[model samples]
Target: MSDTAQAAPPDAGAPPRTGHWKLIGPGIVAAATGVGAGDLVATLIAGSRFGYALLWAAVVGCIVKIALAEGSARYHLATGSTILDGWRSLGRWTSWYFGIYILIWGFVYGATAMSATALPLAALFPFLPLWAWAMIAGLVSAAFVALNRYEVFETVMKLLIGVMFVIVVAVAIMVLPNVGAALRGLIPTVPAGSAIYTLGLIGGVGGTITMAAYGYWVNAKGWRSPAWMGIMRLDNRVAYAVTGIFVVAMLIIGAELLYTAQIALTEGDRGLLDLREVLADRFGPTVATIFLVGFFATAMSSILGVWQGVSLLFADFVRNIRGGTESREELTTSPAFRFYLFWLTIPPMALLAFGRPFGLVVVYGALGAFFMPFLAITLIWLLNSSRVPKEWRNGWLSNTLLGGAALLFIVLSIAEIARLITG
Candidate 1:
């Protein structure tokens, strides 16, 4: 098919449209996938250290992600091609970077996701050790992704986010947050010594490699052409709006419950467990238990999302590498997909038992740091070039947002690499 012929929607003259709420799927999956336990913990730390001072950062982070996700989906719809295809058009180097990145990143991230998911479960049900719980979480996520198709996976993600939303917001409300302070937080101001936290909150809210997987989710949701552009944009915005709320709610919890009391949390996912104890002391066992459930929902959703979404990405990579033309649906069931599913589940469990290797951790950190910038720069290149239809090319607003995102990620990447080297 001619380029224009392939790019044109089946119904060429359809009216412009907006998304109906019922059509929201890929965005939820993307949002759920992106906002993992680490993002929440970072926001929590920001709130604890500088109560509501960095709230604007969370809001801006969401906006940045919305731009990134929207750009990704727009490419998919405008060109009737995968993001991997767009990358391939850039150069063979894109393939090499992605191939190496996905392999190393997935192996490390698998353990991280499993460990994050296991934390709350271990806290809530202490009968099982953390490693065992991590293993179970990994296996269960693998099984769910293996058995279900995109529709089922999306439904489950929606349900998980629902549980996450209600419980987290409820906890925030229970804290009786300082409304005036929160409102004041809308004004951007960086307090002394808060530069790192401010940068992290702004650049790390929902940023992840999964942001690049967004187009795959959009494609899996059966949106193949530009006719779905309006809905896609709506879906993307709504998803990040929800993410903003989650981050804000966690910040409120930290501000009201921890900051006021001068209680310091242990770092990492364990910090959440510390918050659980605080909740139990301040409220009761029931409230602490509820927060743990929300924590599990948040972490488990990430596991499910990565297992499914990134597998789709890896499968697409394999298909493109082989010069195969498998439909998105077929890619889900393809051996490449299952192999990644296993790659993300089984091999990583070893990390749980033996501890993450120092060298592997450094490489994972380096690659993970660079991925967001890579994605943002590549999207700008792909969307602005002839690879995309002229009518569908990014406007000034999209370009500005994406350009800013690229700059922000580049800074964060340098910081991460510097940290790795210094340590």
Candidate 2:
């Protein structure tokens, strides 16, 4: 990959003028993959503690992510190169950072994702132990990704998104959210002792390393050039808007049911199980069961998305580092892709039995903490450079948002590292 901008695809013509709605696959995948159990828990905890005070943070979080996702996809569309290619052009150091981060991140994340996915299932059906359910979920997700291509994967993700939207939003409405209070929450007031919760709600909504994979997914969706920029922006915005809805819905549940009752949930994924128990007690087992089903959909979607999206990333990383010339479309079936999918599925099962090693957890947290900042900083570097065509160079608005995101993630990373050290 050269620093000079690659020529646009021959098909690059006038940007699509109609049917923008049809160009929505990658954003859906990005959203499904980005929002997992932990995000839901974070927003729920914020609402439980502070009522509707941090609603502004959730909306801001969505906007921050929209900026990040759009910037990443824009680089790919404008440069006729993958995000990894842009990183390669930056220097060898980017590769070193990513290489170390992806390996450690995937190992810990595999066990974490499997456990989160298995939580709802184990709660719903206790015949199988949590570990057994986790292993089954991991294996099934691996198989699903292994057997399907991007089109099939996108179809399943869309279906899961529909399920999540219907169920979670339905439950929030059932709680009869105070319209006036939720409206007032949009004012951005932070109550005493709620600063960290406010930051978490603002920073945690639908954010993940999979965000960097948005470009690969954009390619996989057959939108390979600058002509698709309009639809891509539309797709990115719509996806995060849906993500905002999910975050708000979870916050509503927490404020109405738990905050009002003065109830506290156990920390981590188990908090969701606690919510199910509360739902069962208050609304009956039927609604609780439905929520459990929705939880499975949320967790499973993350599994499928990571297994597919991040694998595409790992595959690209390998190709870039090895100087391989395989096209982006071929990455899904590449040996490197299969190896990463396997890495994400099998080896992490050991952690399920023995538990995450303290050292590994420290490294994972440190690396994961800085990833978003790294992404923000790099996009600002890449998009403003000679690599991207001048016509597609980021405007002042993009620069400001990306700058804010960098500062925000840097703050969050420092906070995360402090927490790990103290613990």
Candidate 3:
């Protein structure tokens, strides 16, 4: 967090339903955003390859994210400053880096997210090609955010999350996983030849630049005082708890369904499609369609989350640069916010048609890989600094978690970069 100027209170109309479980909005948004199409594929792959071998690692991943998110939302409410404002206090360079990062990151991710979300929809409605469905997905997601206030956006996200949860749990139960093996998988042993994946699973669960957007969401949700801290903590835990279960459910499906059959899935988003085929063959099209709907929810939630959350960062960035103040309402409706929403949805449509360029993919991969480490490092600095109130500063446990996250991500970043370069 930066020693940035404190923010003013949000416009005085909305009620603060502090301490209520119903007030758990932003954490849900962040969790849904974190567990996107890529994460789903990764979790599924983990299960197929090592039937619950890394379940303990998944548990660790959730704990680390809980710490990071707790620190982030804590900073927001404690300081009443957006994460952008905090970063700016470090130096103008932080703003410049984020500005460029969001531009490139959003461009590439918009296309990928749209395509991923559209896959099941396209399969369900093959009258249109994948690209056509991608376009529709992008447009529909954009319109959803543009139309909804934060409250409505959160409500819709919760609804989708319910659908996602029910389907994933249903699939896991259908697979009839061995209860004994799964319990032992929770014993924290890392099998040989699985170190890289173990680390990746542990470090990558429910994370991305959306981790940073957490603070913005907290701010947008009217949880702006230290008094709201306990509520934020509860909300953060519940969010990642949902994420933890979703990952585990997919793992169970992979372990029991695919592992027994000795199935190998393709890499990336396409793997989910392959799984859909397998599911349809084994369980019928109706069951497969239900799972696909869950897949759509996973991908589309990210689209909506980035649409609302990252654009909030853009609004804050512009506000800091111009040395002006804007209420939360103004930021949401600001041209900067809406423009990035358009940036994320529209220009990427071209990538859907022409296909992504090699260089663009490399850039996106490199930037995306580095963000966790960047966030981990900056968060440790911010939470320990004078910018946040002393009482709200990180305790030793938080420090240990953030430090471990930074170190873990540094290793993951190097591995990802090496893979991109060799390919």
Candidate 4:
């Protein structure tokens, strides 16, 4: 890429950029961050229990995410503002809400992300306890993000994603998914008692609060004007295309192996551990070992993803809240960014030793539910308002999809709340 291709706006107040792709980075980072072991477990559980019954739901999730990402990317390209800037323009309340939410979200997610990354390693080695592995994982992720720029960050992310893709796809092929059943799954039907699982498959399709970080990634990639729109779109599409394939492959493994065998795995990352045993039984120790490595890749990718992306988010939040101009370089090196990165990596390790406090888990779960609808409703509001330029605004199709996403998230959020309440 030339200096011209990778340049930021000549003036901060310049018009929309008319640029195209010489490189694709942020989209891969976003997709990898969005799908952790939790996502894989959810898809696998859905597949094993439901047997491709929610394939369309997973597809719907990919579509919803694409819409959210595009709207976010467009806002940055059109306005040269971070999502925080856009939100701040909406009201001071947006800043307060995000500032509070990011603090709470990062603290809780830090522990979970670290633990997820540690699980496969613990299982593989069996020498160190899970908590010890978790501590090491957090330290490694923090040190890297604290030192690297977006270029190195992106390179490492793509490499992790490549490893993830190969291992999962190989597992899927080994399973030999039922072609007719999978095709039927594409038609979209809810079997008895599977409504919530179906909704989860659809709504959980590779998303998180990190969706807002799409613009940060875009800016980090040096795409600031609408001119880079073509490259942005291409990058975004490729990201989700890869995400959808990974989800489907996990589903195939679930349906073919677990469903047929009438065995149900435990939930969360431990579920993948159970999967390793099954793979060892069916294939061999070597294949299961490879699968476990892929599992680590998925979990660690998420840890690094949030380590880089959300830290950027926090740094930007500090810049805006302080009423100071924030250059990308300044933001990357800013104390606030490194502080959050340290916060994400170091403090959470305590949770591994002491165990996550019960009171903390409840608060974490509630706030987690709060984010998806928050992102969806906020996007619909931001893109449709005079805030965005007419040319870059949402079309009817985009609005319809976003509107549907808001509704879907609303429904799902309600379900999560109810589950929390009743249980």
Most accurate candidate by TM-score: 2
Error of 2 at 242 (Å): 0.5
The TM-scores, one per candidate, come to: 0.95, 0.96, 0.95, 0.94
TM-score of 3: 0.95
Checking candidate 3 for backbone clashes, the offending pairs are 1-382, 2-86
Worst 10 residues of 4 by lDDT: 6-15
Candidates sorted on TM-score, descending: 2, 1, 3, 4
lDDT agreement with native, every candidate: 0.89, 0.90, 0.85, 0.85
How many clashing pairs per prediction, in order? Answer: 0, 0, 2, 6
Candidate 2 lDDT, 20-118, residue by residue in tens? 787688998999889998888888888898999889999999999999999999999998999999999989999999999999999999999999999
Candidate number with greatest lDDT: 2
Q: Name the runs in model 1 displaced over 4 angstroms.
A: 1-19
How far is 299's C-alpha from truth in model 3 (Å)?
Answer: 1.4
Q: Which residue segments of model 4 deviate by more than 4 Å? A: 1-22
Q: Which 10-residue span in candidate 3 carries the lowest summed lDDT?
A: 1-10
Predicted candidate 4, C-alpha RMSD: 3.5
